[model samples]
Structure formats: C-alpha cells, structure tokens
Target: MRKPLQHIWALPVLAAGLAVPATAPAQSIDVTLVNGHPSIFLWVKHLTETFIPAVNTALEGTDYAINWSEAYGGSLAAVGGELEAVEVGLAEVAAIPTVFMPTQLPLQNVSYNTPFGPSDPRLVMESVAMLHDTVPGVEESWHEYDAEYLGGGFALDNYVLMTNFPVTSIEDLEGRRIAAPGPAVNWLEGTGAVGVSGNLTTYYNDIQTGVFDGVIVFPTAAAPARLHEVAPYVTITDFGAQYAGTLVANRTWFADQPEAVQNALRDAAAAYTEAYLVEQTDRVAAAMATIASDDDHLHVLAPEERTRWASALPDIAGVWAENANGMGLPGSEVLTAYIDALKAAGADLGRDWSQR
Candidate 1:
C-alpha cells in the first residue's frame, strides 16, 4: 500500500522555518499530461488516479506543480501520433506506447517481440530499467524527439484473446476475422487469421456487431468495455509483455524544472508504475472470473493449444530488428542488451530470443 498523501505532504511543511530547513524551497514545474488511450482503459485510469495523485504526493512541499491536462482518447494527439505532438510542443507530457512509434523509438519495442520471456512483472520492469542503463543511445532515443523518458508504466502483458466465438486452438483461429491493435498485427501473421486494424475504443462495437470474431486486448480495456459479456473466450497467449507504455515530459519543460520538482516527478512516476501494475494484475483475475461465471461464453485455451499458437506466430524479434535497422536505429544492439539482461535475471533459453 502507498503512504497517504497527508504523510507525504508533511515532509516539506515540517522543515519550513527551521534554521536550515529540511529541504530547499519547493520548486514547481508545469506540464500538460496527455495519452492516446481512452479515458476508461487501465492505462488512462492509472494516469489519472495513481499517477496524478502520486506526483502530487511527491510535490507535497514543492512549489513545482504539474499542470495536468489530460488530452485522452487521442483528443490531443491521434493514435500513433504522440511523437509528433511532443516534438512539436503540442503536449508537454505524454504516455506514449512505444509499439505505436516503432520507427521513431525502435529500442523500446524489443520487449514486445520476446514473448513468454518472463511472467513476473517486477522482473520484467527491472529488465527494462537495466536495458535503459546498459544500452547505448537508448536514453538518447527520446532526445531527438524533444521528449525526456520519465519511465515506463506497467506492462499490460502479452495480449489475451477475447472472441465472440470460441477459439480453442490454432486451427480454430484460421480464417477468423481478428481485431488487432497497431504493430500487434505482426504477431497474428501466418496464423491464417484475417487481421483487421482497430483500437480499444471500437472493440466492443466491432465484437457486438460481429466485426471481429475476437480481439487481442489487455484485461484493463476488456473489463471496462464489458467485452467479456460479448466475447468471453480469454486465451492467455502470454506472448510476453510489450514495452507497453511510457511516461514522459517535454524535454524543454523538464529541463527547466527546479531540482526538487524533478525529484518529485520521478518519485511519482515510480509510485504510479508500481500501483498500476498491481491494479492490472487484479483486473486480469476479476475479468477472467466474470467471464468464467458467464459459463457458455468464457474459455481458456488448454496448455498444449497455447503452445501450438506460440509456435505458429512469426519470430517477431527478427522482424522488429530488421524494421528498426531500416529506420537507421541501432536495432540489433539494443535487442541484444535486452535479451542478455533477461537471461542474467534467470530467464530460460526457450524464452530468450537473442540467442535464436
């Protein structure tokens, strides 16, 4: 559990007026927070509830304040357009999905391709931190875009399969119209599944109207949309977590912040990440249970069937690296560093794509 906001508030206030006040004068920095996801998604919920409040806790005594302007559901920036929005100063802070901007930030997508590498969210989070620390130009990837990478939010985990029709095996998925989010379509390639591009906002309607047999979505979005009611077959492919989402601020604005405010923002980002991770884990279970209780609709793929699907999917790592290289980024090197870190953390060879 997180410490109360009141407790966090007391730190700066207690030191004020002292001979050498416990902390320096509080510094405040104003930033406009933005996101491409809808208001109902877990990522958005985390942004509003856990993130905003946590930052406020960090700034308890600081004069630096976050001017939170939530331009959600792509109101400020369309899906796959956050990079331009930040680079052009339309937004001061953004929670951009690295997958959405693969060409611009290829290094971050390494995790998305390495499926089933690790299920522990804590280890996964640490792997990302380690990769950023060890990889060259990794942090600098953001500099060119005029944004500073604050940190990563929770990995929503490899997507689960939610279908209006039950799909129990790779054979079952053949020729079915599947709704996949951007870049994720690569995973469905060669599965004989017909892929359609769609975002979470349109998922419920699409499924209800039979636009798709099912969609690959995170539990966070599925539960809120009551997708379980429509397409209850939740198949946990566990394809590994995508680099998921990022919490970042405009580099120009971040650079001008007082040290205290910067520290506060950092602290808040970490707090928000941890809390959101826990929340997502809970949502997965709750969503699963709800669908299961509905009986006829909900189904989980058997273990052997899951293995078959995993085997059939393309080796996304090679595709990702090649794509990044084509974009003139250090695609192969960053991928190497990510794989090495996961192995060092005790990841098994079968799940390590670097060696492959």
Candidate 2:
C-alpha cells in the first residue's frame, strides 16, 4: 500500500496548531491528491515535496492520520479536468488550474483578464486571496463546484516567449503561430500572431511537429520542459506574474474529515503557498539562465516594443468584466480591487485595466 510522503518540507511547528484530543479514537483517513500536470511541473513538485510533508507533520500525535495516494501527470485526470475530478469525488484533493475553468471560475481569472500589471508571483496570489475575502462570488464559485480552496496556489513568474524564430520586436511575431495555455491565448491579440490553445504537456512536440512556432510560458516550466532545445529563441516578454492555479479539497470530503485533520490540511496548504512561491521565485532566475546560453540565445524585447504590443491589444479586460457582469458576477468590482491592490504594492503597471 502507498504511504504518506516523508519529506524535508515538513514543519514541526505544524503540530502545535492541530488539536490532538487524548480521548479520541485513532483513525487513518485515505486521501488521494491529484494534479493533472506531473511532478515535473514546479507546482506539482511543491505539492509533493512541501505540501504533503507539512500535512504529515501537522497530524503528528493527532487522533487522525492521513494515508496519501497521488495521481499526477494525467494518471487520473488531465489538464483542465481537475475541477470535475474533485466535484465527482474521484479525488479528495487537487491542484486546479483556474485558467482552464474560465466558464466556471470567471472571477478567478482577474489577473488573466488584465495582463502586464504585476510581475511578482507572491503579490499576484496574495491579491487573489484578498479577493476571495472581499469579493462576494469568488469562493462561492468554488463551493458551487463542490471544492473548498486551500491557499496553496501556483503563480507563474513573468511569461516569456520561446520561438523557433528570433524576435526583436512585436512585429516580428506577425503571422507566426504561437501556443498559449487557456486564457493566455487572449494575450496574443493584435500581435498579428495566431494563438493556439495548448498546455505544457504538448508544447515541445507540438512545436517540433510544426503545430506552432513558439510558446508563451514561464521560465520555471520552460526550463523543465527543455523548450530551448526545440525552440531556441527566448524573449523576455514581461507579461508579468499570474495566478494560474491553486490547491483545493473536495468540499464533502474536506468537511467530513476530523477537525484536527482539517486544521492540519488548511495550515499545510498555507505553508504550501509560501514554500511554492519562495521556491518558484528563486527558480525563475536559474531557469532563465539554464534556458539561455550561446546556443539558445535570450533576447529582451525593447521596452517601447513591449509597450507597443500592450497598447495594440483589444480591451480584453473590459470585455471579460462585461461578460462576468452578464453572468451576474461583480466583474468590475473584482477587476478594480485587483488592479488597485497591485498599484498599492508599487507595481509599475504597464496598463491600468480599470481605466481603459
């Protein structure tokens, strides 16, 4: 039988917060954690290396124990299928990519709707958590799907462009076919490049097979994929850090767990958020360095060139907000709050979506 992971990310302090009752009966609860992307993905790695160990540490000496089973790399669910997996009770906990659930989680796509705003992954996710508190319909959407969100979120570092061809300006991308995941596809507007919907799993093969010429992705993931070998041109796009996904527990399962177990999971989830971001932030530079070398040359698109690209894009933010409003969500409110918070954090936004 598979056992709970024993890992270095364990925190002894996590035990203090768990309520261990002396009279409680010992029980081992089975939990299966699912991530569509495999452990090679930075977020999934942290969920395994940091989140799971902390969860074990939190439950030490408690009346409840968790027997963890993992299903990753689409063993149980594919990218964009995580929400349904938890809702159907196929898994107890999961790392859900919100970008793939735009129709169901429109409010969670605030950062995707307003791009080029913030570059700090930590700030982006913290702002999203704040939205969960201040925004009325945010968490409610998750509840509607029978999932309870834990704070362990996967936020992307600034997105860069990897292409088979060199790009010194936005115009160079004209007529090129580029792959982007989910809402990121919308970012290609007015760049004259065709945006193909895709995820990390298929990027390398797809690019090599002529499915696309390039991909817009972050360094942490790009390095692991070894995208440089296939598409050697790396351009720093500065599209900014984005909150792509988060950890969630099946609502019914999470509620049914013992309070002590629940507390531990929740605390560990928060720890997952911190640990994931810390590692991700650190990995970004190293990943970039690894992906860029003499053979795989790195280019920084001129500041004015990026600004030109940003300006040419349509009002995706307004359109997204209006669509949300059509669905009775507070689109304007969420957008305003997110942008305002980023500004307050000293992010030199390239464009204020709330304005235009």
State which candidate has the highest lDDT: 2
Q: lDDT of all the models against the reference?
A: 0.74, 0.88
Give TM-scores for every candidate, taking all chains together and pairing residue i with residue i: 0.84, 0.91
TM-score of 2: 0.91
Instruction: Report the C-alpha displacement of residue 75, candidate 1, in angstroms.
Output: 3.0
What candidate 1 gets wrong by more than 4 Å, as runs, is 1-29, 294-296, 346-351
lDDT of 1 by residue, 62-178 (tens): 566666677888798877777778888888777887766656777876776766566566667777766777767777888998988887566765467888777666777789999
Task: Estimate the overall C-alpha local distance difference test score of candidate 1.
Answer: 0.74
The count of backbone overlaps in candidate 1 is 6
**Tens-digit lDDT string for candidate 2 (175-286):** 9999998888999998889999999999999999999999999899999999988999999878988989988999998988888888888898899889888888788878
Query: If candidate 1 were superposed on the true structure by all CA atoms, what would the RMSD be?
Result: 9.3
